[model samples]
Target: MANRATGVPAPQLLFDGSEEKFDLWETRFLSCLHILKLKETILREPDEASDEDRWKNADCYAELVRLIDDKSLSLIRHEAADDGRKGLRILKEHYSGKSKPRIINMYTSLTKLRMADSETVTDYLLRAENIITALREAGETMSDGLIVAMTLSGLPDSFKPLAVHVTQNEDSVTFAGFKRRLRVYEESEKMKMTEPTTDNVMKTYTRQGGGHSKPHSNRKEEDANITCYKCGIKGHKARKCYKKVWCNYCKNNTHAESLCKKKGGQDGVRKVAEEQGGDQDHLFKAKYVKSDRPPGNVKMKGIMVDAGATSHIVNDINKFQSFDNSFQSETHSVELADGNKCSGIAQQRGTAVIHLLDNAGRQHTAQLRDTLYMPSYPHDIFSVASM
Candidate 1:
């Protein structure tokens, strides 16, 4: 795909001249060559390569030259551009641990390695493996036992149990075996935390000073007593109601397009909000509203009108005229089209300025009441349904 900013095909690999990341960069470079069916051409010797292969190798060599930094390219500039194999060998030899200082640095880094809190086990292992690979290529020996010990030593305190389990096991633990057992242990621990407990139910009965309590009904029995809003039937809520009463106008399942109150305009905002699950009485929805083209002075591109949006949302705090910082609690959140909730502790609601331009190019400003302020919101949305 073309890059959005540059309108050019983005480079597949971008190497920042660092010896630590060279191995990964080389692997990706070779993989790209393989995909283009030019890996064989690059690998073949100049003497053995056919006339057609020589032409293909030029493209492969160009890709190599494009990916590497200027400093790395200068090392192999004397090598023929048509001979990718020889140029790549020269680049590899230069990067693959020729310096004594670099080897010592790598060894020092390996010893001082400690997993960060934000890093996952797999990511930490990959980092350790990269250093080990670099050490081996530098002619330094690395044993599997030493590799396991180094890997285990770098893990954070949370992974101590897994380390202990690996060490105390009857069978010797390879790095591969430890990874497998770690996956299983992590999943099992998650299951233990998430699984529901009857301890709360038992505690409820043990509470003091309460009269003889009636037995709680089972979930199925409770659902049977509840009425569904969608179909006016017992046993389920509107969300679970099987009856499909579709309103094509509002795209709601509760009613038909022909019977849609929203078609009448502002009168249906409250009714539509109720159906859409917005509990806030002051929820804004744009049913029908006239707006003129905003002149260049106003940032018309920054403002977006969402027809399906249940509330007006503003990203910038400066847009608010008179704000209510405590308007909404932390638990109150706005739902997105993708079924994800957007919430922040700093979220506020109040009157906001809405800039507009008339047909005569006269600038006008209107007050947008009950507009939500989400500092982390991606866009300033004017809800058509909340008008």
Candidate 2:
């Protein structure tokens, strides 16, 4: 007779359990096919649908059913759909009927499915076995090959020897044993690659000399103090003493003019000496000569004096034949100590050589030093010509 709900004659009852349980298995199988179909669709058209839509619309269970009918289950055995539903089916069939022998057979079939493709099947079986073990101990023991396959699946690619160890010793298959074997496998892999140790890492880091650890050194500190000649101080040298003295040339008590030997003047001189209680030999002599006109137009021939000079300069201006003939006129402005401006001409030809007459009337050439460009200079036109 036609069934009211399905609108077809009901098939003869084949199993003893309620139709609902069988319907559940059928629905689960269809759901797996739906998942596969959705996966293939997404792989082909990733942008077309969201992940949830693909899962909902997949037809993996239908594909599995077709695979079983055509005896092409081997073709799709390692596929995601088969792995999901087939493992569930085997477990359900094994536990559903009150048949211990049939349960063992079902387990054998499941193990065969696992061995067909070690990568996919081993992980699935491990999870299944863990669940099965938690619920009820596995009556059927695992074969050495299956255990090896399971172990190999858990280990990293470098530690394949762990799988071999498991295959060799199947009787002592415990979590602790697996961990020990994994450690051994890792050590052997490192030895094979000739990898270094923690000490080598520390040495490499330490040699860089910029790490958190202290630097390695064998040298010790030495003394750096010298005695000062003028003041007899121990912290500094005599060259750096800051005593002041009178300048006999400028008649200024601010500094001794003997040390003010710079030709142009002490317009940019940093420090000056003061009048301290000392003998004449200890004090510098003042030497100055005044003129009415600007020194740029005058001819100068005297010793090149560079005492406390920030820049090269010429003091005496009466030695050259004519200052205008020796130097081509280029407008150069200089700044004085009183913030006054003065004009000068740059020498374009040979150096403005100075022939100095010492106290003995002996002639000696004074060394021409380069002009100093102090910040006090109005413009940077105080450059000296190369001699």
Candidate 3:
């Protein structure tokens, strides 16, 4: 079959100087070069290609060799570097390691594979897998059970219920079982976040008897729609109405909603007092409105708050401390204030808790329900509404 990439597929194994994956880097790099049929030329030196036909192949390899990074490039030095086999061996000898520091670093990362508050189990496992793979390559021995136990211990406290059950139950506690159960939990929780909720309108009672009153019923809401004859809303009598008496001018609580915005005045100046007319007569009831944009911020536990935003945004989804699998229903697009549009994009929603310390030194925690994880977002925008 033809290659999946219609045109050209970008290189995946270009070395970016991350020494931790040198073993992986070398294997993938060589394999990719070989697949392109350029490996023979790059790996074989001109001198080794004795004939005219061999020299042409060697020349092609030499040209592609420049695609390699500077660090590895230096290993292909003057005479010794000319030959592909010798150069590959030299690159391996220098870059590859049984080095104490590399192994120690890998072990340290494995030891600290924590499932952060914002991180999902799957992402945490992938991180752990990478660390475990590195350790294994370093000749470190780790049993599957021990690795599973480590993974379980790293999950957040919210997962404690399942974590405890898995650990305590002998029959359903294998690595595979844990992975399956964890994914199931993740799917269920995500569903709760995206599902439409009906309890938007809550009944409020007057001063003293609010808590003891019966909850609003669907029958009354459906029949009367709780048209507050007082506030023009349904469900409650005038005494129990909670709609605010608003002012259009001077924007203050002192204004009344019934007074005309252009006409409220002592000296022809509008000073809206709280509208007592809310109990006078019902004009028209306002229906609950759902906005097109998902209004709250998804809290990011470790991110600094950006208070000037209308909704939450992260620079990169991967930069998110934790991420769930793709959760948006449609391709979400964003239009900037400048009238530029970003179209057909994928966004993930994240949940996080933010900690705040008031001026008086009292600490409070706020939970963000759904944060937009936009990989192309240029900056973090923390929303006050979400906060």
Q: All candidates' lDDT scores?
A: 0.63, 0.38, 0.53
Tens-place lDDT per residue, model 1, 1-387, is 235798543454766778788898888888878877988777766666577877887887787777888888888777756567777888888788558988888889898899888876667778887998889888898776677777788877877767865664546667677767766776776787899853221111111245553333364554455444334455654434556565666555443344454464322432433342311112222221124324444334235556656567876677788986656557776655433343552378888886665557665776777788865443467766557
Which run of 10 residues does model 3 get worst, by summed lDDT? 267-276
Q: Give Cα distance to truth, residue 174, candidate 2, Å.
A: 0.7
Candidate 2, which ten residues in sequence have the lowest lDDT sum?
A: 272-281
Q: Write the per-residue lDDT of candidate 2 for residues 1-387, one digit (tens) a residue.
A: 225797442343122233123434444444444544544442243555666555543443343333232223433345435343443354344445336764555455444433222433335445445433422333555554455454456444545435644654426576545545655655666585786432211011122334463322311110013332233334432344465444555443332453343333332232111121111012212222224457665433222222222334443333222333333234654433222344542332222344444567565664434333232221222122222
Could you tell which candidate, 2 or 3, scores higher by lDDT?
3
Task: Quote the lDDT for 322 in model 3.
Answer: 55
TM-score of 2: 0.19
Ranking by TM-score: 1, 3, 2
Off by over 4 Å in 2: 1-95, 110-160, 167-171, 175-387
TM-score for model 1?
Answer: 0.44
Indicate which candidate wins on TM-score: 1
Residue 191 alpha-carbon offset, candidate 1, angstroms: 3.8
Q: What TM-score, over all chains together, does every model reach?
A: 0.44, 0.19, 0.41
